[model samples]
Target: MEFFFYAVPSLMIAGFAAAAYLLVRRARRLRRTWTHGLTAEARCLRMFTTAGGGGGDTSVHTTVHHVYEFTTREGRTVRFEEENGPTTVLEGDFVTVRYLPELPQRATALPPTPGRLAVGTGVGLVFLGIAGSFCVGFILLVHVIFAESDGLLP
Candidate 1:
């Protein structure tokens, strides 16, 4: 029981930290690739919106998805579809895309956005808040238990 109290909280903290680390790592990598990679104009072939997550609520949040195609430096063409957040890219619009020279498939139509960073930070904060609550509860419980055992509490 004592081991569980410490081990569970430790595991939860580690899990949250690892998730945040991965999110930050991926965002950094995407930003670096966008900054250093080759850029080209891609034509958006189609655009669509899909409702995400929410159901039974009148206000359903939707995400815009766009399909784009661009010709690489080597004369090869590549097509990719990605979520464009709230901004909608119209079909036939020539949007800028950045891609690696060696792996053209690793590309993004937009630079690294702040949404991922914000989400990671929010998750970490929420985890910390929960862990802090657990810690406070544990400390209070230990104090009460010890006081009662010693007959210090009337």
Candidate 2:
């Protein structure tokens, strides 16, 4: 009981922190890739969509992904896939590619948009809410279990 009292809440808080850190790091990486990365023209090789988790009355979601290839300034050809693309993009269409100088394969077909970043932000918020509620519930349960006869409620 004592271990559960402390460990679970600590884990929950740590999870919340990790999620926030990941989202922020992604935003920063996208910003840097847009500002400092080299650009080349890439031809979309394929486009596909996979349905997200769904069952038992849960609504299904889908994500679009694309694979493209471009040659770097050094003449090395690289292929990469990205999940976020405009709806108008189609296989065989040419799109702008941004890639890191040192790692030509690290590329994105589209720059980070406010809408894409907002989706990550929203996901982080939902995770925070879940972890926060768990921690709050833990505190209340501990208080009730260890409360004196004086009664916190009274």
Per-model TM against the reference:
0.62, 0.78
Q: Whole-model lDDT, candidate 2? A: 0.81
> Which of the numbered candidates is closest to the native, going by highest lDDT?
2
Look at candidate 1 and tell me the lDDT of residue 37.
Answer: 83
lDDT of each: 0.75, 0.81
Query: Mind giving the per-residue lDDT tens digits that candidate 1 earns over 60-118?
Result: 77778888899999999999887853365688888888888886776788766667666
Score candidate 2 by TM-score against the native: 0.78
Q: Give me the runs in candidate 1 sitting further than 4 Å from their true place.
A: 1-11, 55-59, 85-88, 111-154
Where in model 2 is the C-alpha error above 4 Å? 112-130, 133-144, 147-154
User: Tens-digit lDDT track for model 2 on 7-123?
Assistant: 788788888778778888777777678889889999999999999878888999989999999999999999999896776789999999988888677688886576767787778
> lDDT of model 2 at residue 101?
89
